[model samples]
Target chain A: MNDIYLDNNATTKCDPLVVEAMLPFFTEQFGNPSSLHSFGNKVGLALKNARKSVQKLIGAEHDSEIIFTSCGSESDSTAIMSALKAQPNRTEIITTVVEHPAVLNLCEYLETEGYTIHKLKVDGKGNLDMDEYKSLLSDNVAIVSVMWANNETGTIFPVEEMAELADEAGVVFHTDAVQAVGKLPIDLENSAIHMLSISGHKLHAPKGVGVLYLKRGVRFRPLLRGGHQERGRRAGTENVASIVGLGVAAELALQNMEHENTVVKAMRDRLQEGILAAVPNAFVTGNPDNRLPNTANIAFEYIEGEAILLLMNKMGIAASSGSACTSGSLEPSHVMKAMGIPYTAAHGTVRFSLSRYNTMEEVERVIEAVPPIVAKLRKLSPYWGESGPVENPEQAFAPVYA
Target chain B: MWDYSETVKEHFYNPKNAGAIEEANAVGDVGSISCGDALRLTLKVEPETEIILDAGFQTFGCGSAIASSSALTEMVKGKTLDEALKISNQDIADFLDGLPPEKMHCSVMGREALQAAVANYRGEEWVDDHEEGALVCKCFAIDEVMIRDTIRENNLSSVQDVTNYTKAGGGCSSCHEGIENILMEEMQARGETFMPGAIQKKKAKPAAQPLVTLETPEPAAAPAAGGMSAFQRYKKIEEVIEKVRPNLQADRGDCELLDIDGKNIYVSLVGACSGCQMAAMTVGGIQQKMIEALGEFVKIIPVDKAQYAAQLAQKQATASA
Candidate 1:
């Protein structure tokens, strides 16, 4: 059986060209960039060129602004903590309730340490409340951190405008753009975003490499303080090969940016439209217009997501879910919960995130495979009846054991 | 991915008795969609011998849950109600060559549904005895009696084991303290003196205090050493901050207690601490010390100079009003 992978948001397959660019760094060109030798000069020059490539991909004004880290979480942690360290008198953090766990969990931890956290709410369509977000921006706020796009629902946030507002307030702003980096068009030179984070793995680069872009003149405190690296903004010996791979991936992403918006998006829409038409009572979860081009989150009501995923797995079709059972948590995804999605729909949400490598045939194969799985699982569900699904899905399936 | 047993996979793929019996005499349904799993079990019993003539189940859950329900129907058929009642969650698991530890709750769900079916057969309400006890794990709606009973029956040793067996402390884990309390109580009943932390030791001290009433006031007086009046907790909180002061001072920082309102410990960081990024760590250290010296009820509020001044002025206004 052929594997049809649609879980690209989880991680993308490393491009072979990126692998070819990185192979020489492992054994042949293996030299520490900080070493004062001819070998070091070659590696150091490669690092500089790679930085420029990444800088161009995101439209950053200068290459020096990009600080490479191990992963997206590290970049997120460094950015948020740096803002707090830069302005210690400010004990408040403004963020969204639907942010990835990297930002949400850290903010929660800070809350326990006496920092007041204002988690802005989201509407049913997964759009942030700008009025509430503006109201929370006070002089005491150290930073306003929000994700450029939601990982689960793929809903793009209005970070450009939000960042400008924060800039006007003289407050630091950071965005975890891990999902948005290669999927959307970002012009950091034109935006007021003080910092942005990107994971290499999200854009066909190898894992264990990330980039934190801090605008020059933005006061930053290093999370990892040691011998000067990332121009003293970050520390540790650079991941040479992975960084090279990330650079090549970034360049490739920039080259294929239009294809992603055109061909890849068409495939995503076809799969989404096909699933919705074939599967009854199914609907898309996020905003139809303001979403990532290569992503779609669709909810198949009444049945649980894990069952659907297992049936899909049997057919060698890969996907992901926001269901509580899928995560082994009592509640579904925080993004779904923040949007106030009904439990019936929330428990059955499936996310199909595509990449540049995915073909129309693969999307068609998944569309053909998913409807039957949903229909089969819905048949097994007690809440689903012969006439139709029960009204008030929550109370209709109340616990009979207790 | 789950490493399900071959038996489990077979039963899941080809579930036996996968639908409801139309003329079923007794029906027992358990769990819910919100709980991430649910089962509807129907049984047809022979009126003369009281033997289970047929069993059918409709399950809405994961692979393990469906397999467990399928395995359950196969295990209960052709057995008397008394014999079916003797079938533990372990038996259902054993029939399927055992389930993953984390999926043990699926088997437990099957067992509970069976018990409910038997109760329905006997014309009795499936009144769960465990529900009467105080609720402990709010995330899973698990109660104290359920935690205690599962701990004793399964020989559960830690919170993780309790979670695997009953899913109690499996969610947000705010009820870990309550679960630990029940664990300690059960362990003490078994003549096991070992406890998890100093909080249990503190709890054990109160139980041993009735023997020496005169000595009780002396030890209690130490916690409230400065005075036994309204400001005693405040003075103690200040003392705890004094302990953490040197660590902060080493980093060119310092902390001062601004005010104490109820359990809230209002404090302000000064000098390098005022703009230090590690201020969260410094405040956390002070909060930990306060919890150790005072109690868990202390809520530390780190304020800046302006916020501290506003709070002080507000306190004065409220006092006058």
Candidate 2:
């Protein structure tokens, strides 16, 4: 049996159809899309069709609004940079605490460049503080880049409503929908969002391809300045094959949205319930009410995450951890820490992010395997059955930060 | 994934003498949940000889930490408390072949647990005594003495090296400047020139968010190493690599040093060697000769051409930014 991979939030295997669609671009149709030759015209036409496919997936009005880039990081950086450059008078940037490194690192760099970066806090359940988000939106705010859905917990933020608020404030809003693009329904035609980021690999497309949905008439600047590719909005040679692959993957994502919402979500819930039911001191980390269908971030208290992952690896189960030991930076995930997850469980958080590829059989295998693994690791832990871990996990962190 | 050695995996999977010893006379505990790893080591000590009759441990940490604790328990049996105290963090790692540099803190936790247990047996108050110097790294509970000792012992050049060895500057990194001063102090004491801007230059990627809070800050179970300083080894490696370079340069190839971990020598092939079909063979030949000339078992890990280029580009971007 192959390893039961539940780390789709990291990256997904490319759909065979997507790979097949990409192959022609690498060989016969390999031409610079920007060139004025017949070879270039054919490639350019293919790129336009791919952009249209992406446009339909995101429910955008025009295909011209879609700008293909290398990956999600570049798309996010470009969108934020464009917004900031378009409005130099507004030096303030508002973002969330639990953003992926793509957004957070860029904001950090911007902060060093004398930008006032207001990183808004989240609730104990990993929900954004709406009141704070409302209060922070003001005339001086240059751009507000909030992720549509968190990569870790899959907690889908209310970006639509946030975008409405930003629009009312006359601010340029960008949602990093890298995790949400294909999974959730997005209608940029009706929404007030100026820009959104999407990564191909997050949804059965190959890596090294991404899309930035720029709302029409939004002032922008190119992140990479070279060739007039991506309609002069983005520079450099287009990644022809991956861009074609991304288009097909985007279409497949739309088709598989139903299965993702039902079957995959069912498996995720089963895995979450199965682990929480069997393992003592285990609890779900984020808000379960409005979360993505695929992610189940459960914190198994009293034991560390890396040990559990190692044991699970032996059983052909692949998952990720939020433990400080697992992260090379020697800190538990900033998301979990931000949610104020207790120290005992914080060090032992396991993230099982599912995909349409996962099955109930694989889910069962995980359920059957995880409990014993946690039990074994807990035996070695001094905190287990001791006064170390709090009985009520929610009460772990007493003083809630404002 | 952490490239844990076979011995570490064995010790971690089938831990020895886990759990509290009821008849144990002395007990030592270090680290806390906040720090992500902790150990409570119990020892049955003979009063007359101060020898450990039996040793057991209950560790709350990652694989390497548990394995280190298990290995520590196995190693301390029938050995005097003083003798066990002499067993440094590096010694535990040596027993387990060698742990990944990231997991070195696990071995350090083991050594500290031993010290705490021994101090407990000798009727000494060590838990408080361990916090002797001014606190340098608040997030990791790393004191000035601990940072200085680690820098002096390891001959650490930069804050990153300090982090790898003692986990002093791994956290929020607000104390990197504090660690930098210690590194500067220790390096100058040895008459070695230290790059003062090394720590300050490698800025933290992003500051911690408003939501994330350090609720509990734990102690520094992290200890220093015992060996020929990294500076001395770096010079020896440079001299050794220079010996092997002429042969490679003759073939229109060259290697650039990336990093020098204890047994792991990271280098990137440049010139003709970058995409040569016989690059691995060349690397192997160089490794064999360098080991003989340097009189040390060093694995020369060649960073792939693509990765080397990406790293160089990122470094340039950072410098230019």
User: Interface Cα RMSD per model, in Å?
Assistant: 2.8, 7.1
Candidate that scores best on DockQ: 1
Chain B, per-candidate TM-score? 0.46, 0.47
Q: What lDDT tens digits, residue by residue, belong to model 1 across residues A83-123? A: 99999999999999999999998998788679999999899
lDDT (Cα, tens digit) per residue for candidate 2, span A1-402: 989999999999999999999999989998888889999999989888899889999999999999999999999999899888878898999999999999998898788679999998999989988999999999899999999999888998999999999999999999999889778888999999999999999999999999999998988888888877887888889999999999899899989888899999899999998888888778888888889999999998888999989999989888899998887656688999999997778989999999988899999989999988888888777765453343553333221110
- Tens digits of per-residue lDDT for model 1 on B1-321? 777899998988778888788889878888756657888889999988889999998777888888999999999999999999999776787788777655767888899999998889899989654454666765455778878889899867677578756757865667776677677778888878546654434521222223344653432243432224546666677788887677677646788888776556788898666644345655765675677675444677789878779877997799799
Query: What TM-score would every model get versus the actual structure?
Result: 0.76, 0.76
Please state the error at residue B170 of candidate 1 in Å: 13
Error of 1 at A402 (Å): 6.2
Model 2 pairs in collision: none
- Lowest summed lDDT over 10 consecutive residues: which window, candidate 1 chain B? B203-212
